[model samples]
Target: SQKIEQNSEALNIQEGKTATLTCNYTNYSPAYLQWYRQDPGRGPVFLLLIRENEKEKRKERLKVTFDTTLKQSLFHITASQPADSATYLCALDPPSGAGSYQLTFGKGTKLSVIP
Candidate 1:
């Protein structure tokens, strides 16, 4: 069974600083690593995805890194603001299935940016 873990503690950062979150998995190797943001009472919104072959990926003020060997993924938000505050989740598809769209998500790390 594949298990994913994120920081159970909430993350707090000052506005304008960079916020980095970690996700770790065991027992399986996924082909893609995905990051999502979820606000209270809302569904997770897709943020970024990095393929197993890729070392890193970036979009706007967001960046994601996947290290297959380490079985970890790091998600970064540059120039963070209060509006960026949300629970971030890491998800991955089943390791050995073709046409499988199922994804297992981490417990998520809540982020709060203070001004």
Candidate 2:
């Protein structure tokens, strides 16, 4: 069975600092890694996606990395702000040929940026 895990504890950071979140998986190899942000009572919104072959990807103040060897992905937010406070989730699709579009998601890591 495939499993995904994220930090169960909340993460607090000062505004203007960088926040790093980790996602780890076991028992499966995915073709893509995705990051999403979810606010209270809202659905997850797609932030970034990185292919297995890609080492890293960046967009605006966000960055993501995929490491197949480690079966892990890291998501980073630069110059954090209070507005960035939310729960961040990592998801991965089943490996190719699995005939499923479903994605396994981590429990998410809550981030709080204090001013």
Candidate 3:
């Protein structure tokens, strides 16, 4: 069966460096991918999405790369800070009819930005 996975462990980083998180999957192909950030006791907030045909996508201080050939995605936060500490999740969209798409998320990677 298709599965999405992330590091089950937490990541520790310094306050001024780039933080890299990884997402990996297997057994099936996805139509697109998405990343979200979730804080304790709060729902996830959407961050970035990329289609299978796209190689890479970016926002102000975040970047995402999707390699369908490898069935993996890499999420990056440049110039990360203590305020940026949170759990990041990666999701894969399985093919579905329009307006009926659903997303399944990986376990999520917890990132801690130390002072």
Q: Estimate each model's TM-score.
A: 0.95, 0.96, 0.92
- Candidate with maximal TM-score: 2
Compared with the true structure, what per-residue lDDT tens digits does model 3 show for residues 38-77? 9999999999999889999999899999998888999999
- Model 1: per-residue Cα lDDT over 54-81, one tens digit each: 9999999999999999999999999999
Model 1 ranges with Cα > 4 A deviation? none
The parts of candidate 3 lying over 4 Å away from their true place are 96-100
Residues 13-100, candidate 2, lDDT per residue (tens digit)?
Answer: 9999999999999987798989999999999999999999899999999999998899889999999999999999999998789898
Under the 3 Å rule for N, CA and C atoms, how many clashes does model 1 have? 0
- Residue 95 C-alpha lDDT in model 2: 73
- Identify the leading candidate in terms of lDDT: 2
Per-prediction CA RMSD (Å)? 1.2, 0.9, 1.8
